[model samples]
Each structure stands twice: as structure tokens, then as C-alpha cells.
Target chain A: MAPVTMIEAIREALDEEMQRDPAVVLIGEDIGVYGGAFKATEGLLAKYGWERVIDTPISETAIIGAAVGMSYQGLRPVAEMQFMDFIACCFNQMVNFVAKSHYRWGGPVPMVVRGPCGGGVHGGPFHSQNPEMWFVHTPGLKVVCPSTAYDAKGLLKSAIRDNNPVLCLEHKFLYRRVKEELPAEDYTVPIGKLAVRRTGRDLTIATYGAMTLHTLEAAEELAMEGIEAEVLDLRTLAPLDREGILESVRRTHKLLVVHEDVKTGGVAGEIAATVNEQAFEELDGPVLRVTSLDAPVPFSPPLEEHFLPQVADVTRAARELARY
Target chain B: MELPEMKYPLSREQLLDLYYFMRLTRELDEQLVRLFRQNKVVGGLYSSIGQEATSVGTAYTLEKRDWMAPMIRNVGGLLVKGFRPRDILMQYMARSGSPTGGKDGTSHFGDLQERHVVSPISMLGDLIPVMTGVAMGGRYLGQKLVTMTWIGDGGTSTGAFHEGMNLAAAQRAPFVCVVENNQWAYSTPVARQVPLHDLAERARAYGIASYVVDGNDVVAVYQTTKEAVERARRGEGPALVESKTMRMKGHAQHDAAVYVPPEMFEYWKARDPIARYETWLTERKVWDKKTKAEIERRIERELKEELEFAENSPLPEPEVAERGVYCEGCHTIEARWERPIEQLQPPKASVQAAWTVSDFGGTNGGGAAAKAHAPEAAEETKPAAVAAKAAAVSTRGANGGTKRSARAAARPKRRR
Candidate 1:
């Protein structure tokens, strides 16, 4: 009934899912007693107890690998990475095993690896990261980055219920920043559907996660200048809502993608290429992107601020595209 | 410890069964090698030649509920766990009807539900954590099951080995980590791989009970693994069993093993597990020449039937490649995006103006949400200035200064 923070929404989703399904469990460092580095999993241990909310050692390989094994035994495990930057440690497990298990053997790994991702929190290279592209490039994995609390809860519920391994990337910047009134009744946002956060006519700003907020701000700023910019939230990266993206681009005839991940090899490039291949005739201007610099997330506030794409950056990109 | 006086833990029938399994595995390895040489096999064959005892012995001790994560050299273990030889042959032949559905050939085969086996990942030691988690999940679910996973001597050097073992030990998971220290990790010998003489000693770092057994002795391996499995089922936590054997052949059929020391090969060859077990069985009067001949003939007939089945199995259709990349009911991003753009929903008009920080609840919320952004921060900086700074940074393009040539130039010159 009331608006809840993204972190709270995530916590509620885990809490409700564990209650709904006995097979659902939680495993991660400091997740049980410490709540979590960001407290996304706060009160989960207290609610579900230790057996369901397991506190694992600081071993990402073991955490992910064990989650894969647990999935084989019919248990739905939601493993937290504390911070998404550390997920690189278990890259082999995720890329080689978890991502390939379904394709390799037709086995369904009903597991979710959720954690606070994205820069802007000044967590440096080790804590702040938008590594969704890594898993997006990997097949057999569903990647989700919800911008609002409602989507955070709904998408997580869907991810937990889905048979494939899903990477739920929560932006650290939006954990407490984004809040929305959620329905009391249980609901799940389908993994492949795109949410049209704000509709417009002149141009389309296709983005997700924290960038959605900045892009929305940019859209509002452009709207004052008589430019109606549509904001499309790509809730799920892998199994991307291609229909939503193409349709928005077709109407606006202009596209500007935004993301917090590094520009090189980011989802922005993929979207640009897709539009270029499928809707090249509709485009009145070149597809553009406002993404982080191609470098590790700097720890200093100023450097991180410069490294990350801001509202002003999106506004500049959207205005330039609107003119064309 | 000295080799225990060939005590029989199993009855005559079980012993005969074990002997038959070992003989069958040995024959299969020989057949695979011959097939590979004749250019009939699809992939490189990695045999369990001298290490059949280790696989058969440990796998035989596992109950139906227990799971075994085997490596390429654990075909014997797979067979002992009730994996039909014909299915294994079908897998190697890359038939559509194979368990892997021609997805993976050779030792990359497993049946999680039917056979209780976790499919192997080629990145050695990775399966250790997987097996540990399976056991931990089993214990948590109130199932009385023990999980055993195999790794090579070289695998112990990996970071995953330590992580998996430490997790298993700390969690007190019902896991048995079997390190098949068959001396060589590919071409690298154990002596060169680690400074320590015994790999079992590494387990002490995790504070788990460890044992080193004579891998060449089937009875010793079975007895050692049985005790470890019993301890695990008793909730005593994980144990490390190092089966010290040697790789008598090259890593795979492609390798001629010219690098191997002739004397070293001869030494391990003299102590072949199958030959030693045959002698032990004959001495105990549990097996005779007539029984051995009959068993060999039976295995030969079975091998012929399996070969025919593999030959008769059809090759997968070309379209099958696009399938099985994801599980059934799973929709890949590529598949969804492949649809034509015009058929999708038409974009709608904007419902509102630009969104502001306040809309995200800077004032409406309290505590962390309220203090989420520093007050007056927006007024302090101009949007034009920030946009200018961002534009300046964006000009550098995605490839920054980490060019390959630059990195190579930074490397120190090597000494001749």
C-alpha cells in the first residue's frame, strides 16, 4: 500500500518467496546475521531462520557452484554476491557451469544471483560495477535490472519462479533512492517484457536500472523544451524486450540508449546494432549512448561522478538526437 | 600405512561383480583406443587404464541415493553407478539418442535425476564445490545422502579446490572429496605440481580428516571410501581421500607419451590394479580361469552389442544445433529479438514531464532515503558545466590507452 525502497522490495520478495516455496533458500556472506553489505537481505535470517538463510564463507566459487548443485536437487537458491563487482571471482562457475548447465544437459537451474550493482555509490572498482553485460553475453542466464521498487519485487518473484539461472542486478544507487507503492497481492513481472516507464513522441531513451531515473529526469527536462522523450525501462537484459525497443524506436524515429556499464561491449552497443539491423529505415538520427567511461569504476567521488553517465549527459544526448 | 592384508569387505558375488565391472572398463578403454587409432571415434579418448580400481572401488561403495561427480577418467565409476555401457558408447559416438543428446561427447556425460551424477565440468576441481553444495542441500532437505566428487592431482593446485574443501569443512557438509592423484596432471608430474610429498596433507589446512590409500588396490580404495562415506552419513563432515596411483598412459589418445620416463611407465605397469586384483581374487579362490574366460566373453558380446547400438543411432539434425542451448520453456534474448520490428506494439506518447530527484522520494522518505542526496548539491553545480565535463570525457572513446602494443612495450626485456 505504501511506497517501499528498492532494497526493502527485494527483501520482501525474498521473504515472501521463501515462505511460499520451501525449496527457496538464501546463501551469501554476511547475509544471515549481518543482513548483507547493503542490508538488501536484512531481516531475512530473522524471518526464515538459519537453515533457510545460510551464511556462507567468502568464497564466490563455492557459493555459485553450490547454488548450481542445490538447484539440481530441486531447491531454488537465491545467492547474494554482496556486491556485483565480486561476482567476477565466480565468473568460471557462472559462465562455465551455471550458464551452461541447462544447455549442456537440459537441466533447469532454478537459482537467482542477486546483489547491489552499478557505480555512483563510490564503492570503487571492487564494490560498484554493472557486470550485467558479462552474464548477458552468456547464454542460459536471464539478467534483470529493475529500476523501481515495484519492478524490483515483481521481477525478483518472476526470477525465483523461473527455471533458468537469473542474475538480478540491483543498482546500489537506487537501493534507497527509488521507491514506489506496491500492491499487497502477489504478482510477478514476466522476464521478457519491457516496462514503458514514461511515454513520449519525439525521441526514445531506452535504459534500465539507475540510468532509468537519470533518463527520466532528462526526459522531464526535455519535455519543458517541447521535446517529448519516451523512456523505456529494459527490465530484463537477456531475453531483452526487443519488441518494446523496436516499437519505441519506430515511433520516435530516434534512439538514445543509457546504461551505467562501460560503453565498450555494453548492452548499449547491442541495442544500437539491433536497431541498425532491424529498424535502420526508421532512424532519423544515428543511435547514440550515454554510458560510463571504459575504465574501472573509480573510488573517488569526483572521478566516479565523471566516470558515470549523469542526467545532464542523457539530456545532452537526447537533445542532440531530438534535433535530428 | 602398509597395504592391509587383502581383507574381503564384500561377499563372493559382490567381489565377482566388482571384477566384472573392472574388466569391462578395461576392455572398453582398449576398444576406445583402438577405435580412435582407426579414426572411428569423434573426440580424443582419455582412458582410466591403470586407475580403474580407484573409480570402481569408490563408486561401488556409493548407495543409490548418493551422487558421484566423475572426471574424464571415471568411466568405471559411471559404469559402477549403473550407467549403461551402450549409453556411454552412444555418447562418445555423438548420437542424438545419447544422454547428452550429442551436446557433449566423451566423459562430459551425466544424468542428474536418473543416475544421481552431476555432469562434469572440464575445468577440473570446479565440481568439488558443486558436489559439496549438493551434499549440503541434501542434508538440509533431511535426506540421508553422501556426495563424492573426483579430481586429478593437478586439480588440487586450483583455487576452487581450496574454496570447495574449506566450504565443505566449515559447513560440515556430507561430502567425500576424492583426489585421484594419478601422479601426472596431463604431463606435469605431482612432484613438480606441489612442494609437499603428500596431497592428503593439504586437507589438514581445512581441518578435515584425510587419508591416503593404495589406489592400485581395489579393496583398499573401496574400504577407505566406505569409511569416509559412513563418516559423512553420520554427520561427521567431509573427508579427503587421496588415491595414490599413476597414469600409465598419456593424458589422452592424441598424446604418444614420449615425454614419459620408460622406467616410470614400466614401474606403474608392473603394479596394474586389474592384474593385481585378478591375482588376489584367484588366490582367494573366488575367481577361476573358467569364470574369468566366461566373463571376458560376456563383456566382448556386450561390447559388440553396444557398438552396434551406437552405429545404428542417428546423427542429430542440423536444426538441433539451435535447440538445447537453453532448457525447454526457456526463452533466450536472441530468440525474442529475432522477430521483425514492425510487428511489435506502437510506441505511446509521453504521460509526464521530466522526472526529478524529489520524485524518487528525497523529501517524502526519512533517514537514509532523505539523506540519500546532499542538500543544495544540485544548486551548487550547473548542468551545462557537468555536461561539458562529461562530453570531454566521452571523446576518449571506449578503447582508452590500454592498447596491446603499449602493454607489450611496458614488459621487461627477457634474458637470452
Candidate 2:
């Protein structure tokens, strides 16, 4: 079996789900004939046809609204945002309609709103954004960001089947860059569960999406300095895996939360707050975060690199946390 | 004012059913207003006193298989869609037995199982795309069903409305959008909202058909909507029917509507839908004093029973409020498939593009100024041949009764 890229893994997840369930449909801009902006839905149109692979107009509100409506009719629709940053355009639909549907009416809105997110590929402010915090704050919605190819496919498959609105934020930087030979059989990673990417004892580096790769790289760097940093990929952000975070913190006695999103109001703040609330005694030191500066992602490679948390940032944060 | 003779294919019972539903809608809201006065209604009570025909008439065209989403003032549509008067009263009162189980208030309740009614989101014009998706999903399931939803005059200005309309048109989905141009949107006039006199003209930009009808004229609204529904069912894409009417009362029970001119009220008062509909029924000898009195008496009796039921209904326990946020095995939503799924399989489901170039624009152009009830007014106001073409697609249907004496007392004055 050939090793598949994260993009291929995601496409496989969608292809397999559509073939397995007739109710699974895809709707997004450039997703059908254009094969998606990132080609994540490439070849799906020809195989499943247009009804299942819908090329919607550039209307995020309608894309998500239509997905909600489709879900109401027992169709599990996976609506893609051409760029997840444009999700702000449909914020009202997502928050007010989709998120509140189940709570307000007990209608199971089984739909997946998946798209590429996060800054690292020099996609700039509009294309590169980690907007999961918005949906994370929303109660009824479940948010997930997969860092590896295996988790990308597994988590997406689970999200599609889940009877709630799930936001699958794929890191654009890791889409084709990360590759792994996946199993031949079907599998799904449970939502609201974190993945332990690497095991260590000295400190725990909690991260997700593209930052997971950087965290792992930083862990390798930390290992050279005799500091064993365990990398915990916080895949699901909304229902933050508090137990998993505590268990890792309890094992390592030090926590260093890392993410590509801006530091202010980022997922790291929630993770820090959770640890302080539940596992305050278990922590050997104060919880620290390695996150991007609170500013728009610049287009310049150097500035964007500066704006995003890099491998060095995690290593530096983990080193400081280990010393603390 | 004399109305033009328009042939309608409706039975006497169906015609009376229209009147019954409209009167029921008005009577139910009047009762809700009374409930509001008693501090039973949990939220604001919106009165559809004047726009009953627009909601009831347009919604009446829908078959049981079709889907419809109603806005706040479309309580009449809820009745027409088979929602019990008690279901609505209890919903406003936030009782446990309400359709939403006291989770929501006002017209924010839908019957997905039986009536196929999609609940109205507080954010206006959001349902347009939702119904469009329903239409699309229905097509994928190989079911022949048209989806409809109502939007207000102000709501038409929403980005969702434009985007949803475009999606419907581009996909050639079986979708109908009723723009209830009831003059004002929470104190702002339609003129203040948009420069266009006819909101239907907004549909032309999307390359879909649009129709202008006298919303107060129940028969006209029914006929126009029926035509649009048939067009959508035929895969002619979406159609926007702008039902021109007025919101006779304030935005809700809380609003005094002091911004509206006294003459404006008197003018629309002279053209009250129920009064006009009664006159239409009487002039045609469809119902005499005895029949009208019997219908009114039955409505009163029905309202009393439903109100009692609503009052008797228990409030949801505090613990119950904590439940049902996510599916978590609490509820199961299964779509009723009327058609087989095999048609969506492979060869039959294959399509070259998302959009099909339907004959939607010229000749029998999608735009029409349908003057079904207004005849002998002026040469410029004559019905277009397109309206006749649209009529050839559907059969026929019928609108309201009266203002309650409690309405004036229920309405609160605006605070300075």
C-alpha cells in the first residue's frame, strides 16, 4: 500500500464515506469540477457524480445552511469552505442555526463543515487562519484539527457520522507535506479525544494541526538536550480532552500548550484554564503557551514565520517550562 | 372597489377551509396576545393580523410532501401546515408539551416528521438556503418535492436571501420563496429598506422568475404561489413571489407602532384582509350569514379548547432544560423518503454540471405583474401573458376572518 498524504487521506475519508453511505454528500465552492481549491475533493466529482459532489456558489452561509437543511432530511452533508477563513461570512448560520438546531429543536444536524485552516504555508491572512475558537465557544458544535494523515482520515470519518455539527480544521501546511501509509481497513478516531503523538517524561507539549509537526520536531530537539518532551495532539478543541491533558500533565508534571492561532483567546487559553481548574496540583509549574502573536498573519514569509509559532518557539517554551 | 373575475378551481369546502385557517391564525394570535397580557407568554408575541392571507395563502399551496419554513409573523402558515392552535399557544407560553418541548418560543418550532415544517431561525432570511437544501436533498433522494419559505420585506435585504436564491437558481432546485412585503420591518418602511417598489424585481438578477401579487387578496396569493410551486416542481428553478400587503399591527405585542400614520391604519383598515375576504365570499354567495356565523362560532369554541389545553400544560422541569443539546442518543431524526434511493446510484445520477440551462428567462419570462383580483384599474396594471402561462401549471386554492376586540387592549404603547 502506498503512503497517502494528509490531503489524500482526507479525500479517501470523504470518498469512502460517500461510497459507504448514500446519504453522505459534498457541497462547497470549487469542490466539484474545480476539485476544491486544495484538491482535497479531487476525482470525487467524476466518481460520485455531481449530486453528491456539489460545486456551490461562493456563499458560505448558503453552503452551511444548505448542509443543515440537507442534514435535516437525513443526508449527511460535508460542506467545505473554500478557505475556512471565509467561515466568518456564515458565522450567523453556523452559530445561530446549525449549532442551536439540536438544542433548540432536538433535530440531529449530522453534518461536517471541513476545510483547510491554520497559518504556515504563506497563504497570508485570508487563506491561513485557525478559526476553531469561534466554533469551540459555540456549545452544540464539536471542533477537531487533525495533525497527521492517519488522524485526518479517521477524525473526518468520525465527524461525518457524528449527529452534530463538527468543524474539521485541516492545516493547509500539513495537507500534502505530511504522509503516512494508512491501514487498508476502515477506522475512525473518536471526537473529543486527544492523540499522544510522542511519549516522554520531563514535559508535555500540548498541540494540534500543523503545530503538532513543529512540536514533534521540537520534542526531537528537546530529546537531544536530555529533556524528554511528550507531545499531546489536542485534536478536538471544543470538547477539550481535559482528562487527556491532565493525564499528560500528571505524568510529565509540566505543561507547554502550543498552537498556531494567536495567543489571545486561542485554544491555549482554554487549555491553560482547564489545567488550572482540574489539574492545578498535578502541574509542577505554571501552564505556558507557545502561540502566534496577536496580529494578522502577514504575507511576507519572514513576518508570517514570525507571526506563527515555529519549532524553535515550542522548544524554547518547553525548555522554560522544564526549568520552571 | 370592484375585483376582476378570476376563475378558480377550488371546491366549496376547500374555499371555506382557507377562511377557517386564516381566522384560526388571527384568533390564535389574539389569544396569545391575551396570554401575553396575563404574563404567560415567555417571549414577545408577534401579531400577523394584516398579513394572514400572505402566510396562509402561500403556505396553503404546499402539498404534505413539500417543505415550508415560516417566519415570526407566519403563525397562519403554521395552522395551514397542521400545527395545532394549542401547540402554538403552549410554545409561546413555554409549556412542556410545546413542539420544541419548551426549548424555544414564538414560531421557532418545526414538525420535521409529519408536517415537514422547518422552524424559523431568529436570524431572518436564513431559511431560504435551508429550504433550497431541502429541495436539493429531496431531488437527490429522487423525491418529487418543492420546498418553500417566507421572508419579510426587510429580510429580503439579507445576504443569506441573495446567496440562497442564487444557489437555488443555479442548482435549478425545486424551491419557492415567498417575499411577504408587508410594508414595514420593525418600524422601517420597505422604501427605507430598499429603493425598489416591487421586491420581486430583485429576483431577476438571479435569472429566476418573479411575481407581484396583492398579498391581501387571498385568492391572488394562493394562485401566484401555486404557479411558482408548480414551476419549481417542474425543475424550472426557484421563483420569488412578492406578496404586497401591510403589517396592520405593531412589530410585536410590545411595539405600539406609533411611527405609522393614522391615515395609513385607516387605509389598510378599509382593506383588512378578513373583511375583504368575507365580502368576496358573500358577493359570490359562497357563504351567507348562517354559514359565516357557524364558522365564527366553531373557531371561538376551538380557540377556547386549545387555550385551556395550553394553560393546563405543565412547564418543563429545570432538569429537563439541561438535556437535548446534542443528539447523544436523546432523539433520532429519520427523513421520510417518498422515492427510492436507487435512482441516485450511478449512471442515472451522473451530471455534467451543477447547473442545468433550464428555459427560465425569456418568452414566458419569469417576471410578471399578476393582477388576478385587480381588474379595470388601468391599462398598465393588466396581467401579463406569463401569469397565464404560470397558471396553466397549477390547479387552484383560496384567505381570513376578523380582528379581536382584545387586540387594541393587548397592544402596548411605545415609551418615550
In angstroms, the error of model 2 at A237 is: 1.1
Question: What lDDT tens digits, residue by residue, belong to model 2 across residues A232-253?
Answer: 9999997889999999889998
lDDT digits (tens) for residues B1-416 of candidate 2: 23344444566787788899889888887887777898988878888998888899999999998999989989999899899899999899999999888999988989777899888889988999999998988877767899999999999999999999988866767899988988899999988989986787787677666777778878877877887888678666678888878898899888999999889888788877888889988888888899999999999998999989988999999898788778897657565666666645565655454333233434554443321111111222212343446534332211121210000010111111
- The reply for model 1, stretches above 4 Å from the true place, is B1-8, B330-416
The lowest-lDDT stretch of 10 consecutive residues in candidate 1 chain B is B404-413
Clashing pairs in 1: A199-B349, A199-B350, A200-B350, A220-B353, A220-B354, A239-B333
Best by TM-score: 2
- Measured against the true two-chain complex, the DockQ scores of the candidates, in the order shown, are 0.17, 0.50
lDDT of candidate 1 over B42-127, digit per residue (tens): 78788889999889998998999898888999999999998878777777778887887888888777777768888888898899
| Least accurate 10 contiguous residues by lDDT in model 1 chain A | A44-53
TM-score of 2: 0.91
Candidate 2's C-alpha runs over 4 A off are B1-8, B333-342, B347-388, B391-416
TM-score of each: 0.87, 0.91
